[model samples]
Target chain A: MRVFAALVRQGMKVMLAYQWENYMGLVGNFAFLLLFSALWSALLRGDPEAQARMLSYVFIGQLLQNWTFTPTWELAGRFRMGDVALELAKPLSLPVRVLGDFLGRNIVRVLRALPAFAAVGFLMGIRLPDWPQFGFFLLSAGLAWVINASLYVGITLISLWTTYFDQAHQILDFLEGVFSGFYVPLWYMPPALAAIATYTPFPGMFFTPAAIFSGGLQGAEALSALAVQALWAGGSLLILYGIWLGGVRKMTVMGG
Target chain B: MLHALRCYLLLVGAQARAQMQYRFNFFAQVFSMIATYMGQFIALSWLTDRFGSISGWKLEEVILFYALAILAWGFAVSLFFHLVSFEDQIREGLFDRALVRPLNPFVQLLAGQSPIAGTGQLVFSIAAFLWATGRAGVVWTPLKLLYLLGVAVGSALILGAALVTVSALGFFTRRTYTFYWSLVFPARQLVHYPLNIYSQVVQWLLTVGLPFAFINYYPAHVLLDRAADLPWPLLAYLTPLVGVVAFAAAYGLWCLGLRSYVGAGS
Candidate 1:
């Protein structure tokens, strides 16, 4: 706990030093969200039902997408730089250390995003959920962070074999953009594509949580979605641990 | 000129050969690019199906615009990858090495790094262009064909100039990535549809301000025989003219940037 806390503190300090860049990133994120909202408004100009559903989805999806935009490339770069090896030499377990770093980084991002979110809400006339659902929304967001971090860490571990892990990160980014319904709602996707999205783990990262927040899904449906998120989170963690062990063994044998 | 071109070709070939050594990585990069392109196209297709038409442009017309832009962009990226990374090269004093070469620094810098991955985008763009052109069923008049060629060349130069101009900004800021993204992200939006689909302000920005419309939209509008609010039937030919202007301006900016680039740390 003490080690994790120390790492978090260190990560926070490093992030804070680059505070201006984070501000720029926040502004960029807000601009894109506004762009999407405007696009949705244009799309749903005539249809009230679609306007309500799409506005809800867009609002919640933007928030979820922003929340889960993990810097997987940064993690992969660290591994490529052999910094991960030095990190492994520390007393902390690799996953715990990565989780601490991600949490610290996300803390800064969340703080930055909050003002933008409120501003967007005010501008777009989006109403926040009542207290109870807001509580669940926050909880689901926590789970989403865990799922996203584990998936990114797992993907980065593949860098041990593929030196061009940045390529993988790019591919993953494209998939997230398409499949997570950040660019378009899953329900609005063609029937075939939406079916595929339903089965994929991507929805757990953004779509499913966004749906829950927007009150598009509730009760049993929301529970099932959370269950899927947990499954993916657990599966990703296991895979990452396995890969880390294999990579460490290979490095040890090669005298790395 | 021929000798410079030959050297450039040889340099590009060598880079390709070197990259081919990492067969798996090269293939992976190709596949990743294909996926990215496909994803964007899919999104555009979905939008077209939902909206029927954007402003007055049909799906085929929009795809035609995208195909040309993509092809030109692909060519620029592949041919001038080092120019794209000019900021980093300047910072690391790699430009000094090029300066020592007998050839023009611009040519030498372009020859130093070729984006082999861009070949995939080029292939996809060519395929898309052929398919979209065939589907659009436009009569290939001699004038139209000449105009198309002019548009492609002009578009390539304009895009290349824009990329280089952003890269040159690194001389002042010492950080090129942000500038590159700012240019690229907005440029991607331009390729999604015709400039006419946008508001008048956006049209002016794209056509005159950024001059990106010369890359595809204006020439395409002419070829399709579509009437534009802008007068002059010969306005389509202005694409190449705009390209020359943009390239000259970019080159001038690059010279200024070079003056600012102090070899190493201060």
Candidate 2:
């Protein structure tokens, strides 16, 4: 717990250092939200239900989505600099530290996005979620973040095989953004595609949480969504752990 | 100018050769880029698939706009990708060295290479443009063909200039990624859909304030033979003019930034 707390603190410090960048990024985020919201307003046309509900979905979606933005680690650069060998020799567990660091970093990023959320809420006129809906949103969001962060960390562990791991991050972030419904509401997605995404971890990554907030999923349906998120969160971490072990063994073989 | 062009070619040749050394990583990056746009296009296809049209503009028309913007942006970024790290380049003294080099700094910097990821994006944009054109069933007359060519050239120039101006900010702000995206992306994205779909105020912002409308929307309007809501119907034909003026303005700004660099010595 202390180590996690320290990692969180470290993440907050780095985030604070680039406070101006965060502000600028949020401004960009709002501009995009406004553009999309207006377009959605037109697309929804006379459908009051979709107009009202999807606005919340789009508004809150990116904020929850960024909680797991990847490329949080520079493991390959560390390896090149001999830092990774030292890190591996350390008494601490690298995965746990990496997870803690990532959790801390994302917490700072999400907190910084609060102002954008408020602006989107006000301008787009998002319905205020009830207390129970808000609770599920938070829980689902936490699970989603775990899944996303672990996937990214696992991808970075490819440093165990190659000299670098990059250019891949852009594609990953793009695919994740689309699949998780940050760019568009999953409800509007082709039914078959949306169903497939539900079984994968991608829906839990953003759609489930935002859908709950928008009241698109409720009662038994909402509980099922939460279960999916929980299963994905644990399942992805265990799989990532297995991948990391394989990567570490390969690194040892190469004496890297 | 010809000499500069030759020098640029030589620099880019060296860059391409070095990039080719990592053939596998290069191909992997290109594949990643293809996936990136495939994902985006899928999202777009899903939206248009769900709703027949967004704000009365059909999916084919929207795809045309989207493809044009992607092509222009792909060209601009490929031309000025090192500028993506304007601050880092300045801090690392690469910008200073560019200044010292006999060759024009912008040309050299423009010649500086990006990863192979960009090639796939440009290819994808071209494919999308062709597909949209075929699906839309627009009559491609000779004059319209010429007009489309002009539009392509004009958009590339304007976007490339925008990138240069954004990069020049490293001289003053010393941090640009945030500010650059705020200015660049919103306007760039606005073009992906018809400007008419947005509110009048948003349209005014794009047209008068930022002038991004001239990049893709106006040319698209001309190509599609759609009349503008704005008073002057001739404005749609002026995209090339807008492009030339924007490039001139941005080029002048770069000179000013260069002067500042000498005075400030950062």
Candidate 3:
């Protein structure tokens, strides 16, 4: 915990230096929200219930997405530069330290997105979730962080072996977005695609939380969703650990 | 011009072999690229499935918009990566190195990088274009066939010009990534849907100010034999001419921006 706190403090300083990027992200988010709101409102014209639910789904789904966003673009360079070795040489264990870094970055992102989400939500008529749902949302959100971090960091760690995935990265990014229900809620997806999305752990990232918050999944269904998310979270961490063992061995053999 | 074309081919050919050395990497890249490039089209299908059509444009018609845009953008990006990624070049000081060359920096930069990442996108676009042609029930004629090829080349030029124009801002500004995103994002995102969904003001803004419409929307409409909102439908045939003019204007901007560039001192 102490190590995590220290890392978070250090990460915040790094984040502060490049704060303008977050500001621009906020602007971009608002623009997309405005346009999507207009598009959905027009697309689902007669079905007001579905439309309202969708607006909330998009709003909260995208807001939470802002928190757990893991960038793949820099994976090739940062890992290739021997930075991973420096992190490994630290006194603490690596996965924990990386989690600390991930957590801290997300803290900054979530903080930046709050006002933007609030303004957009209010303007777009987002009904505030009840207290119970809000509490559950926080829980689901924590699990979501685990799922997203493990999945993305595991993929990023693959750069140790093959330092180039520029094209793969683009494809993975798109697949992740669509599968995670970030682009559209899985409910609205074609029946086959939606079913396929359910079987994948990716939906634990955004859709699970979005559904829980919007009360789309409730009571027994919500508990089952949380259980599924926990399953993915645990599964991802294990895979990440396994990948790290292999990657570390490769890195040492390469004499980096 | 012939010499420049030869140099571009030589540079790209050399790197293409190196990139192909890892067969596994090549296949993974191509497969992943197809998936990534399919995102917008997938969304278009899903939306069209639900809504029947978007603002009077049928699924096939909307797919036409998507396939053409991606095809052109892919070609532009693959061919003119230096321009598409100009901000990165500036940051890494490569743009300065290009400037110091005796040859035109534009040509030097264009000839330097060969990115095969867009190959999958181009292939996917072709597949989508054919599928859309079948679904949209458009009859083909020799002129239409000729027009399609012209539009592809013309749209590629227009997209390349836009990329160069935005990247030129890098010469005069410290950070132009957001501006690049601002320009490119709206073009790719909003342009996928029919122009009629947007307000008259936005339609006008896209048509005249940016002329992004000419890249795919106008040309696709003209080819599909759909009635467009343009006052003179004949203006549709002027796409290639418009593309040449846009590229020339953007090239002029590049020259102006070049004059202002004080190299990022080593």
Candidate 4:
């Protein structure tokens, strides 16, 4: 716990040092939000009620996205630079440490994201979840983070087999966005694609929390969704554990 | 002009050679880029499925706009994408080094890096263009073919002008990544859809303010013969002209910005 806390603090320090990059990321979030909002408004034909519903859906989805953003390239980069030796030398578990760093960066992200989210939400007149729904959202969001981090750790561990995983990572990143409802809501997705998404772990990563926050799912439906998210979170972590162990064993550190 | 083209080829060729050494990396890059852009197109197609068209532009028609926009921007980016990192060039005093050289600093900055990353977008755009042409029901005449060639050149210049303009602004404010995101990129996004779907203000901005519409929308409009419906249908034929004027103005801004640059002195 102490080591994890220290690692978290270290991550925060590193992120804060490059605070301008974070600000730029927020700007990118705003750009995509604007594009999507314009797109949805055009599609919905300026129907205020429908538009407001979509605004909240997109806003909460984007806010949660920025808040829980992970460095998908971190492990790939470290492996490429042959720093895995140093990384493994530490007594603590690597995935745990990575999770700690993710948490640390997210704390700053959430802080930076909230005021912007609030201001935009207000101006856009977006719907907000009620107190009970907000509680469910926070819980579901935590599970989403676990699922996302686990998937990232697993995906980036492909660096063990190959020196460069940039292309692979990029493909997976796009797929993650598509499947997780970061690009389009699951409700709007074609039946075939949505069916495939149900079997993938990605829906737990973004859609569940966003759906909960936007009040798209409630009561029994929301509870069932949470259960599904928990299943995915646990399943991915278990799979990630095996991959991490095998990948680390296969990893050969070459000297400079 | 001949000397400048030779220097541009030499520098860009060197970077291309380096990138080719990693054969797996290059193929994977192109493959994934195709997949990413294809995914976006598929998403759009899915939306069209649900909504039955965006603003009365059918899927095939929108594909014309998308392919043209991407192709123009792809050509421009394949040449000037490195300018996206112009902030780093200035901050690291690389601009100072370029200034000391006898060659044009604009060409130097442009040719200083690899463009292999854009090959995927170019590949996808061309493929999409070929596919869209048949379904779009446009009778390709000899004149229309010539105009299409002209559109590629003109639209690329317009997109390049936008890139150079934003990069030139970096000389004034070194931390201008946010500026690119806030202004240039979103504008790029807007061109993918039919301009009519957007508000009149957005249409005017794309047509006149920044003139990004020349990169795709106006040319597509003219080719599709939707000109009769528009107030200034003639603007559809003015893309190549718009490109020359916009790029010249952007170049003027770049020169002005260059005069203001003091080295980072790091």
The numbered model that scores best in lDDT is 4
Q: Identify the candidate with maximal TM-score.
A: 2
Residue-by-residue lDDT tens digits, candidate 4, B81-111: 7777789888888778888888999888888
* Of candidates 2 and 1, the better by lDDT: 2
For model 3, which pairs clash?
Answer: none
Runs in model 1 with CA error above 4 Å?
A26-31, A52-56, A59-66, A81-85, A213-215, A218-220, A251-256, B1-7, B81-84, B194-197, B229-237
Off by over 4 Å in 4: A17-19, A46-50, A74-79, B90-97, B114-116, B176-183, B260-265
Residue pairs in collision within model 2 = none
**Candidate 1 structure quality by residue, lDDT tens digits, B163-243:** 778777777776666655545555555545666545567667777778877777777777677746456666667988888
Better lDDT candidate (3, 4): 4
Candidate 4 C-alpha error for residue B138, in Å? 1.8
Local accuracy of candidate 3 as per-residue lDDT tens digits, B171-232: 88756676556456655666766766676776777777777788777888776886466567
Candidate 2, overall lDDT?
Answer: 0.76
Calculate DockQ per candidate and list them. Answer: 0.39, 0.65, 0.40, 0.47
State each model's TM-score restricted to chain B.
0.90, 0.91, 0.92, 0.95
Every model's TM-score? 0.88, 0.93, 0.90, 0.90
List runs of model 3 lying over 4 Å from the truth: A164-171, A252-256, B1-6, B21-24, B82-84, B115-117, B181-183, B228-235
Query: Which ranking of candidates, highest DockQ first?
Result: 2, 4, 3, 1
Q: Highest DockQ among the candidates is held by which one?
A: 2
In candidate 2, what are the lDDT values of residues B1-266, reduced to their tens digit?
99999998888888888988888887877777778777877777788878888877788888877887787766665666566667767766767778778999888778888434368778888898888878877778999989877877777778767777887877777765665776787678777787887888988888766677877777777667774754677878877777788888888887888777742343
Error of 4 at B134 (Å): 1.9
